[model samples]
Target: MKLVFVHDGPIFEDKDGQYYEYSYHGLYERYKYLADEITFIMRVYPVEKDTKGTKLPAEIKVINVPNFKSPSSYFLKKRIAEKNIEKQIRETDYAVLRESSCAKIALKYCKKYNKPYIYECVGCIWDGLWNHSLLGKLMAPSSFIIEKKIIKNAPYVYYVTDQFLQRRYPTKGKSIGCSNVVIDKVDESVLKKRLDKISGYHVDNKIKIGTAAALDVRYKGQEYVIKAIKKLVEQGYDLEYYLAGGNRKQSTFLKDLAVSLGVEKRVIFCGSLDAAEMPHFYDSLDIYIQPSKQEGLPRSVIEAMSRGCPVLGTKIAGIPELIEQKCLFKKGSVSAVTNSIVYILHSDLEKISIYNFQKAKKYTKEILADRRRHFYDQFLEEYRY
Candidate 1:
């Protein structure tokens, strides 16, 4: 049977016809295991394929809708995008509406065609808007209402962040809490290298703390991480902070903040790193922090955990579900974050690293794939078109 996936991300095809999607290639991997053929319906805009972007799988077919890249042209093109989405829904056997504002068009077509669809709830856009701009805040109430309606209408639901999204938007449908954070098996040599680093940990040595995210986004709390490090530094702590992801444009604001705080020398902005190179980056860290003000579930934090790095994050969204309670603190509290870091470092590095790695195993591709397959089977068994 054919599965149609709907979301708001834009994918670009390069000169070589290589598919490049930023932060959203995991969708291709997720559906590849569950369906014979898959159609991804999204807002696609073209870009010159430099050697940089990730390639999409061949088994998947892409249906491009209006990306609405130009603000002035949005409304006119959006109507056309709706038509394209309707045509695809008419052809596909089943639909998977990955929750995004873009899916409203697909939702309309699904209802009109009497098509069976499942809603995959990843996060709450309303709560997430606090990190975004004024436009997002102004649009949040309606977005929340529309999201609630969309999920309520679906015959089945799958949630990535179990507690937060499910609690806020309860639905009367078959539901499963399977996170989309997929990781391959951690290399044995990498795990051994992590152990060696911890074994040599000493009190006076410089500590390397790192976090990964698109830093330009205010809510990722890259600034707060720098502040937390500054607080620790004033108290006679010798540590350095490394920020991964985001380009020079995104780092401009953050870099200025580091300079003002006089921690510019201590903060290292490593720009963007590819997925393959991440494990080594995680291995270099003594402590990994994800100090975001909001999230569904953070894939980067889990990546660090899989690499046997001790993790600390703010108590927000689905973070508490991933790591121990002691590893979390009040959201946006610089002191609480500083205190948690100090506590984790003093408590037990080796023990926490072991616990984290073991916990990360549950999120491996093999384990999560089985869960996703079971969910798909149950849905197909219950509601077949």
Candidate 2:
């Protein structure tokens, strides 16, 4: 079957000439497994210098729409992009739109042509705009309206996490709960290496709390972690925060904020780690924190859990569903995070680790793939009508 995937993240051909759809490459890999042909209807852009991307699979076609990195660029280039998306969708057997700003046009064309399509609900635009800049906030209302309409009218809607999305957007058709992030069983050697390192560290030693997320999105609440760490240190606890993932420029603002909060020396900004190297990073942490103000579900928290790292996340979106209520704090709350960290420091970590690891198993690639296979079988049958 030929499937059209509509989203904004651009596909790039790296210096080595390997095709990649940025972070969405893994998701596309799963698509390549199920569909004989895949057409990605997304904004296309050039890869940055000195950087590379994950290679895409063989059975894929990329339809380059106008690349709009920000909402400011949308108005000028939207029409031409929409025309291209419409033309591409016409050739595909079905469309699967991963909810994004660029999806509005493709969704319109799909309806106009009476084409069968599914909505991949992976985020909440309303919550996403809460801490975003002026442009992001301005686009929220339209995005929210468009999202609701698509969810309501689409033949099927697949939510990345059902905890918050299904509650927020009630759909008439099939609503399958699935995560796009693929989790695999960690290697025994990797787990043992992490356990050995973890065993050597004690509570009295420098405690490491880590978060793996992009720094540019400010709403990930790195500042809150800094504040909480400052408070913890003041209470005579030796705390260090390792922020993994993000660029040097993105780290600059967080570093300045850490300095202002009097926790600069304690905060370590480890720029982005490769996928294989991420296991070692997660292994080195005593605890993982997801203080994001918005999310569909955080893949980072789940990954950390898979590595037996105790997780503390804000009670928002799908986080509460993954972590226990006792381990959760309100989003952007410094005092709440401070208290949660203190609680974690005193709690039965072994028990927490076991529980988290078991919970994470539910999101493994094998289970998710089975669910997708079932969903697609029905989708293909329905598309014929």
| Clashes per candidate, residues 3 or more apart or on different chains | 0, 0
lDDT of 1 by residue, 250-326 (tens): 79998998899999999998877767778779988999999988888889988999999999998888899889888
| Colliding residue pairs in candidate 2 | none
Every model's Cα RMSD, please?
A: 2.3, 2.4
lDDT by residue for model 2 over 55-79, one digit each (tens)? 5676677777887555788666777
Question: Which residue ranges in model 1 land beyond 4 Å of their true spot?
Answer: 45-51, 69-71, 186-190
Could you tell me how far off, in angstroms, the CA of residue 73 lies in candidate 2 after the best superposition? 4.9
What is the Å distance of residue 225 in model 1 from its true position?
0.9
Candidates in order have lDDT scores of 0.82, 0.80
Relative to the unseen true structure, what is the C-alpha lDDT of residue 191 in candidate 2, on a scale of 0 to 100?
50
Worst 10 residues of 1 by lDDT: 45-54
Model 2 CA lDDT for position 155: 78
